[model samples]
Target: MTALLLALASSIAYGAADFLGGFAARGAHVLRVVMVAAPVSLAVELLLWPVIGASFDGGAVAWGAASGVASAAAFALLYKTLAIGPMSVLSPVTALVSAALPVAVGLASGDSLSALAVAGIVLALVAVVVVSGGDAGGVRPSREALVLAFGAGAAIALQLICLDQAPHGSGVAPLIVGRTVSSLIVLTAAFALGAARLGATRPDTRTAAGAGALDSLANFSFLIAARHGDLSIVAVITALYPAATVLLARVLLGERIGRVQLAGLGVAAVAVSLLALG
Candidate 1:
C-alpha cells in the first residue's frame, strides 16, 4: 500500500516535471534547456543525499554512472523528437515503450502480481494512451520522429533499470552519482553544439531550473518506490504520469481537456484504486 502511494506520487511528480521540461524546450536550443536542467537536477540529488543516506560503493557508483549515460541519451532524443513531432503522438508512444521495457524486465526476473494488479496495469496503459489524445491540428509526425521517440523511450527505460540494479544499501548515493554524470554529459553536449546554436534563442533559465528540480524529485520517488514494490507494478503506475501531465496542461496552459481525455482520467483513478487494493 505504501509503495502504491509512493508510486502514485512519483507519477504526479514525473508529470509535473515533463510539463515544465516540455514548456522549457520550446524556443530554445534543446541543449541549452538540458544543460540548465541537468545541473539543477544534480543539485536536488545532492540536497537529498544527506536525508536519504549515501555510500560510494563500487557497484552502486558503476550502475549509477551507467544509468546517467542513458539519461543523457533519453533527454536528447525525447526533446528533439518533441520539437519535431506532434505532442499527441510522441508522448503516449514514448510512455508506453518506456513502461513496457521495465515491466518485461520485472516479469522476466520473477516478479509476481495478482490478477487484479494485472488488470490495473492494463488499464493504466490504456489511460496513458487515451489521456495523451488531444487536438494536434492534423499534423502527422514523420517516420524519423517516430523512430526517435522509440529510441528515447528505450533510453529512459534503460536509465531507470540501471538505477534499480544498484545495491539497495547504497541508497541515494547512486542517484547522486547518476545526476552528476548526467549533468556533465549534458554540459559537454551543450558545448559541443557550439555557441552559435546555443545563442540561437534566449534560454529560459528559470523554467529549465524548475524542470531540473522536479525531475530529480520524480526520479527519487521512483527509485524508492521500485525498491519497495514490484518493478512491473511500479513502472505501470509511474507510466500513468501522462494523465497528470495532461491535467497540468489543462490547468497551467489552459489547454482544452477533451471528452476522451476526461474519460481517461476517470479510468486512471479506478485503475490506481485497484492497484492499491491488490
Candidate 2:
C-alpha cells in the first residue's frame, strides 16, 4: 500500500520485537538472545524470499553487507540497553537518534522535505522525548545505559540508510543477505563469549525466536517503505514507534502512563497524520 501505512506497520512490529528482545535479554546473556534471534531472522527472510523475489548485484551485496554490520551492532547494544534500562524511556532515545540521522542524510541527498513533513518531523521528535518521559517518576538510567542506547540508535540509523541504498528491483535480496551476515556475526560473537550453547529447555529461546521473527517483518516493511517514499519522512514517521512500545508496556507490564505520555501519544498521532498528508 502507501509508504505511510507500511512505515507504521514497521514501527509497531519493531516496538513489539524490542519488548520481547529486552525481556529475553534480562534473564539470559545478551549474546545468547542475539545468537538465537539472528538465526530466526534469517529463517524468516528465507520464507519471504519466494513472495518478494530477489535479484542480487554487486551494489546490492555491498550495501546489504554494510547494513548487516550496522544491524549486528544495533541488536547487541539495543538488547543490552533495554535489559539494563527502562524500555519506555530508553527506546525513545534510540528512536529519536535513528530518525534524526536519516533525516539529515536524506535531506543532504535531496530527499525533498515539504513544510508539512518538516513540521511533522519536529513534532515526532518532541513525541519521542515526551513519550519516553512516561515513567518520569521511575529510576533514572545510568550513563553507561544512555551511551549504549545512543550507540544503538546510530547503528540502527546506519543500517536503514545502507539498506535504502540498494536497488529497487533487488527486492528482498538485500534483507536476505543482511540477515545472513548478521547471523554469522552474532554467532561468532556468541561463540567467543561462550554463550553459543543453546539447550532446547531454555525458557527464553521461544521469546528470542518471537523477537527475531517480528524484527524480520519490521525490516521488510521499512525497506519497502523507504523504497516507495522519501527516506526523511519515512524515518521520522517510523520513529513514532515509541508510542507502540510505551502503550504495550502500559498494557503488558502494568507500567504507569502519565498524563504527559498520554499527551505525547496524541501528538504522535497528529505527527503521523501530517506526514501522511504531506
Candidate 3:
C-alpha cells in the first residue's frame, strides 16, 4: 500500500489505542496500564514472526532496542500526561512535536519537500494549536509533562528516521526487537518505582490487553511505512493522528469539537490530501 494509506491506517489505530489507554489510565496507575499492555504487545509481535520473515542483525537489534526504549518512555509519559491533562490538549501537543522534530531534522539535512507539502506542514502545525481548543488558553503545561512529552517526541522522531535508515528485509525484526526491549524497559521502570504490582482485575486486564494489541498493530504498520517511504513525510503523515482522536471523541465520548477544532481538522484533511497528491 501507499505511504498515505499506511499513515491513515496507523493514525486511526493509534488514536483509538490512545483514547482507550487514556480512559483506562484514569482509574489505574499509568505504569500498571503500560505493564498490562506490554506483554500482550510482545505476544502479538511473536505471532507475526512467521509471516514477517524476520531475521535479526546485531546492528538492527541495537537500533531497535534504542527505538523500543524511546517508545517505552513515550508511552509512559503519554499515559501519565493524559491522567493529568485534557486529551484535547495533550494529544495534539505530543502529536505535533512528534511530527515537527523529524521534519525539521530532514530539512536540515537537505531533504527537499514540495511546496504543497510545505504548506501541509504549516497547516499541521496550525492544527496542533487549533486542536488544543480553549485548553491552550488555560494553565501552562506542567513542567513534568512537558519534559516527558518533549523527550518522547524526540525519541520517536529519531526512531522514525533510524528505522527508515535500517537495512531492507530487516525492518520487521528490528520492530520486534524494539517492542521486546520496550517491555523490558517498562518492567524495569515499574520495578524501580514499585509500580509493578498487578492492580487490574480481569475486566481491566482484558481492556488493557486489547489496547496493547491495537498499539502493536499500529506501530507495526507505521514501521512498514517508514520502511517504504521518506522518513520526514511518513512521520508527518502519521502524526496527523489527532484527526482520529477527534473523530473518536465525537462518537464514543460524545465530546464536542468546537468551530476552531473542526476547522483545524478540515485543514488537516486538506493537508494530508495534498501530501498524498504530492
Candidate 4:
C-alpha cells in the first residue's frame, strides 16, 4: 500500500514537471530548457542527499549515469516530437510503450503478480492511452514525429529499468550522479551545436527551475517506490502521469476534458483499487 501510494505520488510529480517543462520549451529551445533544468535538479538532489543518507557504490553510480544519458535523449526527442506533431497521437503511443517495456522486463526477471494485479496493470495501460485524448482530432503525425516519439518512449523505459539496478539503500546518490551526467551532456551539446542562445528571460529561467525541482522529486519518489514494490506495477502507475497532466490542463488552462478522458479517469481509479487489493 505504501509503495503504491509512493508510485502514484511520483506520477503526479512527473506530470506536473512535464507540464512545466512543456511550457518552458515553448518559449525557449528544448536543449536550453534541458541544460538549465538539469542543474536545478542536480542541486535539489544534492540538498536532499544528507537527509536521505547515501551509499557510494560504483555499480549504482554507473547505472544512474546510464539512466541519465537515456533520460537526456528521451526528453530531447519528446520535446522535439511534440513541437512538430499532434500530441494526441504521440502522447498515447509514448505512454503505452513506456509502460509496456517495464512490464516485459519485470516478467522476464521472474517478478510475479496476482491475477487481480495483472488485470489492474492492463487497465492502467488502457487508461493511459484513453486519457491522452488519443481519439481527439488533430493533424496526422509525420513519420519523423512518430519515430522520435518511439525513441523517446524506449529511452524512458530504459531509464526506469536502469534506475532500478541501483543497489538497495543507495538513496539519491544515483540520482545525483545521473543528474550531473545529464546536465553536462546537455550543456555541452547546447554550446557545441549553438542550438540556443544562453540568454533566457527571467520567467523562462524560473520555469525551468520549477520543472527541474519537480522532476527531481518525481525521480526520488520512483526510486523509493521501486525499492518497495514490483517494478512492473510501479512503472505502470508512474506511466499514468499523463492523467494528471491532462487534468491540470483542464483546471489551469481551461482546456476542455473530452468524454474519452473522463472515462479513462474512471477506469484508472478502478485499476488503482484492484492493484491495491492485490
Candidate 5:
C-alpha cells in the first residue's frame, strides 16, 4: 500500500514537472531548459543524500550512472519528438511502450502478479492510450517524430531497469549519482551544441527551476517506490502520469477535456481500485 501511494505520488509530481518544463521550453531552447533544470535537480538530491544515508558498493554507482545516461537520452528524444509530432499521438505511444517493456521484464523474470493486479495493469495501459487522446487536431506525426518517440520510450524503459539494478538499502545515493551523471551529460551536450544559454529572461529561468525541483522529487519518489514494489506494477502506475498532466491543464490552463478523456479518467480510477484490492 505504501509503495502504491509512493508510485502514485511520483506520477503526479512527474506530470506537474513535465507540464512546467513544457511551458518553459516554449520560451527557451530545449537544451537550455534541460541544462538549467538538471543542476537544480542535482542540488536537491545532494541536499537529501546525508539525511537518507546510503550504503552501496561501486556496482550501484555504475548502475546509477547507466540509468542517468538512459534518462538523458530519453528526455532528449522525447523533446525532439514533441517538437515535431502531434503530442496526442506521440505521448500515448511513448507511454505505452515505456510501460510495456518493464512489464515484460518483470514477467520474464518470474515476478508473479495476482489476477486482479493483472487486470489493473491491463486497464492502466488502456487508460494511458485513451487519456492521451488520438490526433485530436488531426495532425499526423512525421516519420522522424514517430521514430524519436519510440527511441525515447525504449530509453525510458532502459532507465527504469537500470535504476532497479542498484543494490538494496542504498538510500538515495544511487539517485544522486544518476542525477549528477545526467546533469553533466546534458550540460556538456548543450555547450557543444551551443544551446547553453540560460534563457532570454529571468522568468524562464525560474520556471525551469520549478520544473527541476518537481522532477527531482518525482524521481526520488519513484526510486523509493521501486525499492518497495514490483517493477511491473510501479512502472505502470508511474506511466499514468499523463492523466495528471492533462487534469492540470484542464484546471489551470482551462484546456477543454473531451468525453474520451473523461472516460479514460474514470477507467484509471477503476484500475487503481483493482490494483489496491489485489
Candidate 6:
C-alpha cells in the first residue's frame, strides 16, 4: 500500500518533469540539454547510492543497462513526438503506451486481477487519457509525432519489463547503471544529430537543467517504490503522471482542465486505491 502511494507520487513528479523538460527542449539543442541533464541525474543518483546501499550485481547491472537503453530511446522519441503534435493527443497516447505495457506483461506472467481491480485499472487508463486534455479543437496531430510517440511507448514498455525482471537485492545499483547508460546514450544521439548546437545561446538550458533534476528525483523515488511493489501496479500508477502534468499546465501554462478529465481523474484515483488494497 505504501509502495503504491510512492509510485503515485512518482508519477506526478515524472509527468511534471517531462512536460517541463519537453517545453524547455523546444527549439533548443536537444542533445545539449540531454548532455547536461543526464550527467547531472547520474550524479544525483550517485549521491543517493550510500543511502540506498545498492548492491553490485552483474545481472542487475546488465538489466539496468538494458532498461537504460530503452529509457534513452523513450525520452528522445517522446520529446520528438511532443515537438510536432498537439499536447493533448501526444501526451495521453504516449502515457497510455507506458502504462499499458506493464499490465499486459503482468497478465502474461499470470498475475490475475479481481473484477473490481480490473474496473479500477480501466478507469485509471481513461483518466490518463482525459488528463492529457487532448486537442479536440481543430488542430491535427502531426503524423511524425504520432509515430515517434508510438515508438516511445514501445521503448518504455521494454524498459518496464527489464526493470521488473532485474535482480532485486539492490535497486540502487541498477538505477545508477540505468541512469548512467541512459545519459551516455542520449549524449551520443545528440552528437550524431548535431542537435547539441541548436539554441546555443538560449536561457532554456536552465529550464532543462531544472527539469532534469526533478526527473532524476522522480526516478529515485520510483526506485524505492519499485523495489517493494509489483511492477504492474507501479507502472499503472506511474502512468497516471499525466494527471500531475496536466495540473501543472493548468497552474503554470494557463491550460484548462475539462469536466470530463476531472471526472476521469476522480474515478482513476478510486481505482488506484482499490488496486493498492488488492
Off by over 4 Å in 6: 136-138, 195-203
Least accurate stretch of 10 residues (summed lDDT) in model 3?
194-203
Candidate 3: regions farther than 4 A off? 134-148, 195-203
lDDT of 6 by residue, 1-278 (tens): 77787887788777777777667667765555566667777888898888877876888889889988987887677766655645556777788888898888877887666776677678788777766554534456777877887898788778777877777776578778988899988877766766345545442767777767777777766767767876667778888877776666667666566776677678778879788667
Residue lDDT tens for model 2, 1-278: 38999999999999999888888888667878888898999899999889999888987898999999999998999999988868888999999999999999899999877788889889988988888776645767889989999999999999999988999989899999998899899888767656245433343889899989999999999999999999998888888877777777778777678898898888898889888778
Question: Model 5: number of clashes?
Answer: 0
CA shift at 216, candidate 4, in angstroms? 0.7
User: By lDDT, is 1 or 6 better?
Assistant: 1
Q: Which scores greater on lDDT, model 3 or model 5?
A: 5
lDDT: the better of candidates 2 and 5: 2
lDDT of 3 by residue, 1-278 (tens): 38778877888877777776776777677878888887888899888888877869976788788778777877777777765656666677778888888787767767677887778777767776677663433445677767666665666676666666556778478778888988998898878876345454222777678778888888888888866666677778778777776667567766666788878888878878777776
Any residue pairs clashing in model 6, and if so which? 88-134
Clashing pairs in 3: none
Query: Which of the predicted structures, 1 or 6, would earn the higher TM-score when compared with the native?
Result: 1
Q: Cα miss at 17, model 4 (Å)?
A: 0.9
Please give the lDDT score at residue 49 for candidate 3.
Answer: 85
> What is the Cα-based lDDT of residue 211 in candidate 4?
79
Instruction: Assess candidate 3 and give its TM-score to the true structure.
Output: 0.89
Error of 1 at 21 (Å): 1.1
Candidate 5 regions exceeding 4 Å error are 83-89, 134-142, 195-203
Cα-based TM-score, every candidate: 0.94, 0.95, 0.89, 0.92, 0.91, 0.90
How well does model 5 score by local distance difference test? 0.79
What C-alpha lDDT, on a 0 to 100 scale, does residue 16 get in candidate 2? 91
Ranking by TM-score: 2, 1, 4, 5, 6, 3
Better of 3 and 5 by TM-score: 5
How do the residues 1-278 of candidate 4 rate in per-residue lDDT, one tens digit apiece? 98899999998997787767766777457887787788999999999998998776997799989989987887687766654545545666677788899989988998889999999999999898778664444346788978987897898899889888888778887898888888888988888876336445323888778878998999899899999999999999988887766666557655556788788888899989989998
The lDDT values for all models are 0.82, 0.87, 0.74, 0.81, 0.79, 0.74
Output the lDDT of residue 142, model 1. 89
